[model samples]
Target chain A: MPRDGTATRTRILDAAEHLVIENGYAATSVDQVLSRSGSSKGAFFHHFSSKQQLARALVDRYVEGDLAQLEGSLEATAHLTDPAERAVAIVRHFEDLGDEIMAAQSNCLYVAVLTERQLVDDGTSDEIVRAVETWRVRIAEVLKEALAATGAHDVDADALADHLFVTFEGAYLLCRSTGDSRHMRTQLATFRRLLQSLLGPTT
Target chain B: MPRDGTATRTRILDAAEHLVIENGYAATSVDQVLSRSGSSKGAFFHHFSSKQQLARALVDRYVEGDLAQLEGSLEATAHLTDPAERAVAIVRHFEDLGDEIMAAQSNCLYVAVLTERQLVDDGTSDEIVRAVETWRVRIAEVLKEALAATGAHDVDADALADHLFVTFEGAYLLCRSTGDSRHMRTQLATFRRLLQSLLGPTT
Candidate 1:
């Protein structure tokens, strides 16, 4: 069994995530979180000083988890010398990420917060922005490497990387509006093909 | 000058739209709208029955305005018989749309509402969903015509249309997050090129 402190924190976060996604952040109350998490008021205050701090922690934890997943995918493809193959692997990882989001039946938490960014504190908004910028830079580096390996000198790797991330964001929005996963799947396939087209013939 | 009734309604919507986008739906109150719009309680109630009704009217007006803009672009391109040219014209129209959105300095209200869909009622949610579906169908019809004209029968016009809409949504999200219009401009260019690549060289 998990330690008491760790268990309480996880429970609080789980309840917060569900509630925040289910209701707007402004409408969600500390009382609701405490009741949903089944934690004492003292315990709740012990872990988080305020709701804003809790939000910041939630965003930070989500970013860490996402970056770790990305790192694992990159490492798994490290042995491959072909940059195009590595890039394709990274794209596949994103597809898997989409699948996971669909399975969870939740909009991206970062996106959820971003939509209501005006209502969030400046610190929380800054953290979310930085996390997105980090993702773009990391993916751009991968695309740059792939472009170098494939001799696809005409393509702008930075722009392409931004496109990749933006398209995913768009795909997620479509899925949420339509109640369909096919939107994401089809867009990702189109993106994969677009990436593949930038490569020279497979050796 | 516009009629008093027409003028008052527009004033109220302008105020509510600004507040809703600046703050959020839950946070923006009827009192705030009335204060911002400089309309009396009787005038406001005469036009909108409730906050929900005001939101619905705002969304409906926005959608109608958008569809009119799209129709104007399509009409401008009606003389171009070449499918590729027509497709490219449609894309250019979207680029202009991005520019307009950036100039306005507001995220799409539909998207803003979509992010907070869980907090809203079914009627509001249904209206948002229907607006998006309308865009998809209209764009798909254009793509279908293009495909038929070019004999690019292999392309899935429906999926491609959905991609176009999804990319726009994504680009808007990026711009909102980064506070940079360049993000939308670059992604729209990439999408335009993607559409061009689907066509054979201009005959």
Candidate 2:
């Protein structure tokens, strides 16, 4: 793809994601996305064959960006050899995400997309499921490493990872509905405490 | 409300709610609702002046029904004078709700409604916020009683209540996305364990 072509593609995807989050996928039309992106119909057609294709691209971009961010956060703590410290670092990264969510005017795009997945095609829905699984596995790897480093014998890393992921989503819903970031902060703190307790004295 | 008239109104509301959950607030049209409901345009107009009105009524009905169910669950455990028992009973009630959510084969109405609230009116959004607060306060009261009973002064009843609420919403999201109810069961179990740990030995 040419540079401008890539730029236009990104612009269109950005507009679609924003509109989908604001008005929902079913209500957001291609025309609206074009209008919002200030791109011509020809450009959109050149980039994506159809609205469904556009949706798929949007989710793909979302997942890629999400994973990249998670990897970047983990990489920031790569120098730390201790698993417990790395685990704490992971929690800290999520806390930063919670802050970003609170500061952002809208709810998470993945959440909106997931809620409206019934209206979307199976490919799109499968992408979302895979995205979630990918997140779970990535987080679990760090937690498992932390457990190994700490010599913790009793903890279930997979279950704990799922618990953390679910709680984070729950906190997002609460924060979005209540229009209060304090709840998110408190929930993160509680999870941090739980982790600390489980790990036993975060050295 | 006359008997037949009330029945018609309920029929319309039920259809609207179902459509909204399956689709979304923005995508679900009055026409679709009418067609599914087998109700006439005149009846829809008579029951609700506009689509917005119908949406409002749907949310109002959801909140009312939700509060009633919650109160009923709390009342069921009213006989338990011990605060710890009451707290545990409350968790069990939520577990039952998790079961109901799983069995429903769709996401929670409130979750859908809240996600779509940004597209709805401010009044609708405020109603959702209030409904969430009502749930939190009611659950917190029970947790507070348990804290007092057990002399467990360390736990913040309000925060814990919010956690439970957030976790429930998150669990709903997870279950809806994965098409699996086991994640919800696990989240609930983790919450129960947290409560047990805080309350100290469920006796």
Candidate 3:
């Protein structure tokens, strides 16, 4: 695509994401997307046929680009060779996602869609479920590596990873609601102590 | 009040709770609640003058009754006198609440109310926050006692309790969406290990 077309596409998606972030996927309209993006109906129809199609593309972009990039942050720090620092970095990774999470508001889009899965079909729901499972899985992998490096056989590394993801996601919701960053800090501190205890005086 | 009046009041509140749970608070209305409850307008006003009042009452009841009751389960096992078991019980309280949470299907009433606090300030949202804080305080107290009992003095027990509450509340939302109780087990296991680590040498 040419520069203009690429800009139009980016603009449309940015507007669509903002709208969904602001009003949820079900409530946002293509017309609103165009209005915000300054794209014409012809432009929208040319790029995407329907709102559902646009949503699919938006989700795809969100997954591969945004979520992937965030995961990459942890992956980048994974080879640090220090379990304690790795664990701390893992917590901080979640703490940093505050911006994307805030932009998306208090609930994850996948979560919101999951709650309303009955409106869709089992197949679509499963796809969304897989996306979410993948999220936790990635976090778990990082945690598993960190735990193994420290030889923390006492800690249920996989369980801790899953629990931390759920806990962090949940804490993010509370943090956003109460406008307090303290909850995230509290969770991180507890997570750190848990990791230390699991590893037992790591070198 | 007469028996009939009391019964009617109970029916009305139950219906309202269901409506609020089934539909978001703003999406639900007084007439809709009345229709759902099989009550007339006069009867609804007789019980509660307004929808805002009804939500406030629900928040109050939920905070005072339902959420406050969670500690009772932990208290029941307090005599175990073991930090490890007490820690497991604390996490189990949240795990057990998962079923009640799913049945309610409100998908985080606290989030919903907090999400729309500006629209309805009849003390509903504030009550929800208060309720959460109360849980944190209570948990912290139990944890303090547990810490002392188990001789774990290094960690800050109050912060740990607050983190657990926030994390559990957050996880419950996601678990309800996924309909997966397994994660609750993961959470419990993590909680146990963290306690063992903090308390050290459970045997």
Candidate 4:
């Protein structure tokens, strides 16, 4: 593809991502994506054969960007002297996501799609589940670092990470429903404290 | 109402409630309700004026029965001496719902509807929200009593109750997706301990 073709593809992908965020997967249509991107049908189809392919691309883009940024942040604090502090860093990384999600006027479309998911021949739900796996892996890495800090090494890191992933997703949806962040934050606070307690306090 | 008339009406309502719980309000069709209940068109219209009305009735039944059972469980724990213990009691109540949902093979439709709730008209969402409010009130009442039992009368009972309810709902949904209750249980464990800390140490 030429440079212009690549640019057109990126524009259509970005527009589809935003449309899915605003109108949701079921509600958003191909026409909306084309209109939002100012791209012709030929241009759109030249890049994505279908809307699901475009959505999968959005999920891939989001997961890659989110994980890259998350790894950069955790790289700073993973070696902290305090396990609790390391855990807190992980908590705050997700808390920052809460802020971003709220500012972005979304509650995590991955979760929204999951909640609305039904058994179907479509790959949308499959993409949603795959996205969650990526998040779980990200959480697991942070957790391994946190567990290694403060000399706490006995716990199952993968399981704890899985726990955090699900809770965070659930909290995102709950916070969206209530239109408040405290529920999400308090749970994070409580979970962080739990890790601290398990590590027998940093102070 | 005649005996058979009341029987048919109750059957239709029961089926509607089940369908709403299984498939959600938006996804459940009048024809589905009719097929599930073995009721005809005239019978469905005779009972509910619209699908929304059927959902309203399902909410009513859920609030009166399922929600009541949960609220009553929380209320019964009022005699516990510590807010921490009462928190455990509340968590246990929802833990039971994990089984309740599993046995029914139905998702916690409340959480499902809660996430996709914009699709539900305000009037219908209001009633579901009211049902949630009732649950919060019950938990808060128990918190008030339990806090009183421990002589810590000054804590913000309402806020704590709301926190507990939001966590309860979130945890239930998390448990559903993760298919394992260990994480949710531990998170609840941490919340329970946090309440214990707030109560101060016993002599």
DockQ of each: 0.53, 0.48, 0.39, 0.27
**How much is the lDDT of residue B172 in candidate 1?**
75
Candidate 1: how close is chain B to the reference, as a TM-score?
0.88
lDDT of 4 by residue, B1-203 (tens): 78888888889988876765544455567898889889999988988898767766766666677576765776777677566676666766555444545565344555545544444435555555666567667777767766776665645566566555555555554554454545455545445544554544441
DockQ value of candidate 2: 0.48
Summarize candidate 1's per-residue lDDT along A1-203 as a digit string, tens digits. 35999989999998988777666666678899999999999999989999888887788887787678767878887887777787877777677666666676546675667667553447676765676677778877888887888776766777787777677778877877777766776787667655664554362
By DockQ, is 1 or 3 better?
1
lDDT tens digits, residue span B1-203, model 3: 99999888888888877765544565567888889889999988998977788888777776777565766866776786666567657676665665564555545555445445342334556766676677777777778877787666777876677666666655655565456745654565567666666665653
Pairwise lDDT winner, candidates 2 and 3: 2
Please give, for residues A1-203, the per-residue lDDT of candidate 3 as tens digits.
Answer: 88998889989998887766444555566888989999999999989987777776776676666457556767877686676667666666655654554555544445334333332343334444455567667767767766777666767656676666566656755664555656665566567666666655652
| Per-candidate local distance difference test | 0.74, 0.75, 0.64, 0.61
The clash count for each model shown is 0, 0, 1, 0
| Runs off by more than 4 Å, candidate 3 | A1-58, A81-88, A96-128, A142-157, B19-23, B26-53, B78-88, B93-106, B117-123, B145-154
Specify the poorest-scoring 10-residue window by lDDT in model 4 chain B.
B194-203
In angstroms, the error of model 1 at B153 is 5.7
Across residues A1-203, which tens digit of lDDT does each residue of candidate 4 receive? 89999899889878877666544565567998899999999988888888767776777676676567657667766677555577667766665555565665545555444444342234554544444466567766656766676455646566566556555665665565555656666555545544554544452
Lowest lDDT sum, 10 consecutive residues, model 3 chain A, at: A115-124
Q: After superposition, how far is residue A203 of candidate 1 from its true place, in Å?
A: 10
TM-score of chain B of 3: 0.81
Taking the tens digit of each residue's C-alpha lDDT, what string does model 2 give over B113-194? 6676453446676677787888889989888888887775756778777777777777777787777877776777666655
Worst 10 residues of 2 chain B by lDDT: B113-122
Docking class of 4: acceptable
- Best candidate according to TM-score: 1
